[model samples]
Target chain A: MHAPADPAPLPGDRRHPGWIAWALLAPMVFWLAAFVVVPAAILLVYSFCERDEVGGVVFRFTLENYQRVFDPVYLRIFARSIGYAALTTAICVVVGYPVAYTIARASEVWRHRLLLLVMVPFWTSFLIRTYAWITILKQEGLLNGFLQAMHAGGGPFNLLYTPAAVVIGLVYAYLPFMILPIYGSAEKLDNSLIEAAYDLGAGPVRAFSAVIVPLTMPGIAAGTLLVFVPAIGMFAITDLMGGAKVPMIGNVIQNQFLQARNWPFGAALGVVFMLMFVVTYGLLQRRGARLAG
Target chain B: MIEIRGVTKRFGSFTAVDNLSLSVRAGEFLTLLGPSGCGKTTLLRLLAGFEMPDEGVILLDGQDVSHLPPYRRSVNQVFQSYALFPHLSVRDNVGFGLRMQNVPAPEAAARVAEALEMVSLREQADRLPHQLSGGQRQRVALARAIVCRPKVLLLDEPLSALDAKLRHNMQLELKHLQRRLGLTFVFVTHDQEEALTMSDRIAIIHRGRIEQLGAAGEIYHRPRTPFAADFIGQANLLQVAVVGRNGTTARVRVGGGLELTVASAELPAGARTALVSIRPEKICISKQRLDTENLFEATIEEEIFQGATDQLRLVTTQGTRLHALVANESAMQEAFHEGDRVYCGLHLDDLVIVQAE
Candidate 1:
């Protein structure tokens, strides 16, 4: 992991009061404690507790909730969730890299305009945007209408409630995350190094693979984390796009809390999902570190 | 091995490399020496095929490679920033060219090892670029470029980033390597001392044109233009009007009253006014009367104690101000101070008339 981006210390700054540093750090510490640490602690406690018949939690400790998380039914959902997230991440990379690189290499005025276009979708609510996709992919939607108007073979395909629709929604929602980070990396890449590669007898393909790709790997890694971790836990897109037919791990956990009213089991599933994210993140960080080394 | 014929490159409205033609002899260390933005780097880029010329043909070993890309041409460049691949190990960086060329794996490895050995960076071959210091990184850049074994190697101020001691050592090492490999090197630098020390022939560039190109000693002692004379070393330029023309030397009037004779070989034809270049170190200041033909009495206006010499600023009686650098040995004996009158002698051979800029 990179070091925190603290500003360089000015000379003779040690004479300031000791409380100043604490004052500067107070807000961030309070935010993490209140939102991140407190929620995780509550989840951990609830994962070990038993739930009552009416969805109320019991004070007695038990291992039943944890045992339920390891069952084959949830494990299969977990594997499918990982599969969909990985597929989404791979598709995002293949589609986003060229767009990011083009924007990074564009002229200064055009670069900012293009980046603004990339972020314009975030101005609207995410659920509204997902609804917009549902409109486009549903039967008699704009896409099918266009296809029918063109007299294309195969009438009104059932594309709205499929696994492909879910993957498409996931990729569309998280593609900008991939683009922004890779653009940051590509913009900072030195031009002369590319020239040096060409000067050393590398063609366009070889120079890109040997020089440009490696130089921008950090941004690619960061983008992967940003898209992959959250994608695995996303429930709304899978529910709306898959019509709740294909229950991912996220859909299962959501069902446990609301439809099934098993609060302790949902807490156990949430804790396990959080652990998977931590493990995946750790593995990615290790790979990034080795690549850099 | 390379010939640049009337190459002209323009960026938008600004002409970077003007209609300039130059030729590089095979197996010679030719340096493009000038201050920054004088189009020296542009010329090097043109020869390396990084930037195509707008109006000329670049022939590499009798082949017209002007329109070809850098990879198709047999030329490599060591960039000013070193440009070492930060993500790759030194070995991989050096082997990048061979890999691109589809060289066999075992042969590529041996050549990479040989290149690393040449740079004496064998131990650091497996380390990434950031793991090495500036000098080692510089050597890695050198090895990476040379491993391709190109017909010409373009070095764009490759030593500018190193510390003084390391830069000096690298200069010697580079010259030795060039000789050992018998490869043509077209190096560029703004440092005159570095140019004088490392170049087999220095092309003194000014305003996208070569002001003078010759051997180091020749360019230093016999500069053809006023810019060449002043840029190579410290020279006191005197504006003089041509008074009379002799067989080979011409009598010129300095300022208003002082008169001197200088060789007119380098002077532009039919020029009524010319600039004479007098190297300060060649100016002799003596307390005793000297028998030189071009001798004048001058008062010392200022004296600066340099480490090896005393820099004396003198104003002639006829209102010609001149700077003289006298050896510390004689300067100590004479102990010339400000306001002291002294005799300044200018040898006829030392006074050269050069073309005005």
Candidate 2:
């Protein structure tokens, strides 16, 4: 209603055609269409098709691939993946909230120092960090070595190639991602609002719950998305730390691509994974917008 | 009653508050008035237990509550920015303190309702703080503080953020609310007008020390220090000569060699320098000379129209400047233009001789 009155554009300025702008941006548009949109189309098409003995996708319509996704084995793996991601999101929240709050509330010199500490671990390659954990948790690795040096150690521990190690690696890798977002949220939080909470009779615990948590909810949502979504399709951490002993859906789909030579099933999994992301993210966004409102 | 004794706060080398001692009487509305960076807010924070005094003790009802946290202290502050909780509905914000003390749901709700009604914000209970107007939010903040019924209510310039019209209205509203509740209010502000209107007693702070503390009327009509006279109200601080001294009253000479009778217990004579405090409102403006004892001729140097009143800045023939306030719109309508000659006189009780030899 209060928009400043802008002058009319000159007739000469109309020479910049809309289609020329689109043509200038064609590369990025086509790249998304090919890499993201086209692959999604292929997955959508393949989800309804049958597969041949040689693993080529036969373009005959069928509901069998989606039905296979709901089978007991795949269903169990899907449930397990959700449970792991949910637990990872919850733990990241419980652990990261305080770290972010501390960093945000620290002195200016220490605030940057703490935020830098949270980010510095990312200087090395992410895969290398996960692999480094594999070396540490191996049968005769540093943990067992330290345990043995204490003199009352038992035989070599079978910690390697377990779900626990995968969970540990996932948490360690995603903790920084979680912290940065929560920290951004906490940093923007008004100090006066917190002081007001104290004046209102909120003891430390109630203040954090009713005021601090709700105020920083956007950061929690961002951190949850940053940690949970990546945790779903994680392969390297599970393959190295979980020792390929148990078949997670990530490894299952990886096997179809490399070992089993089944392009159709991999395409089917790709389509389902992308759909899960779309649905989960859509629900998350709507919920976030509602809370923000 | 609230007492602050020898309290000091320092952050590294910057001493925000120096050793300061003051007390607020029960059911009294006292303001800590000073300019910005004068430690009024710091003193308020020390009383609220937000910041601990590095040197001395704070007592509430003769009990040392210095080391206690803000939550443990029986005091509430209406923050300068009207720091209402953005996330909660107004009802929840007002009920926050009650909920913390484990007050039952029904009782806490009743108190919240009463407090909201006290601030005339009962209809805004469902709205969030951001949804309300600035004045409404300020009231919600006030309601939140008084809902707890703390022994002491500290207001840190709660109306400073408001627009001029709203601030003026809220001042009267807050004064009425404070008197009705009979709760001790420790108000802080840099605005002298706000201090004069709402305060039962005004403690004028300067450089972390109290320059003067007395009844509003006493502080305004008879300020003892030059700083207090200048800071608390726009006073004309001019040099005067001590012509002679009786038992209590001293005869002083202003520019143009005009003598004015000023109250002084006793003072030495043969002195050329003396401090005189005269409020702009007390000086009478005349187009012709009057039968007044202290009168001088001056030309208008500046004429400022402030709606109902006009402020006239005059310079005497002896080159001493004085400010005069004319209350009538007709006085302003027919007022002398800049450079017009006029006779001005000062009332005997209106002048306070701050320092005399």
Please tell me which predicted candidate would have the highest lDDT against the true structure: 1
Q: Provide chain B's TM-score, model 1.
A: 0.94
Docking class of 2: acceptable
C-alpha TM-score for every candidate: 0.94, 0.91
Worst 10 residues of 1 chain A by lDDT: A1-10
Which stretches of candidate 1 lie above 4 Å from their native place?
A: A1-19, B267-270, B330-333
Candidate 2 accuracy as TM-score:
0.91
In candidate 2, how many Å is residue B285 off? 1.7
What ranges in model 2 sit over 4 Å off? A1-31, B241-243, B246-248, B251-261, B266-272, B331-334
Q: What C-alpha RMSD separates each model from the true structure?
A: 4.3, 5.1
Clashing pairs in 1: none
Candidate 2: tens digits of C-alpha lDDT, residues A19-97 = 8899999999999999988878887887788878877878899877777777899878877877877787888988988
Candidate 1 lDDT by residue in tens digits, B60-177: 9999999899999988999999988888899999998899888999999999999998988888888888877788888889999999998999999999998897888889999999
lDDT of each: 0.90, 0.84
Which CAPRI level is candidate 1?
acceptable
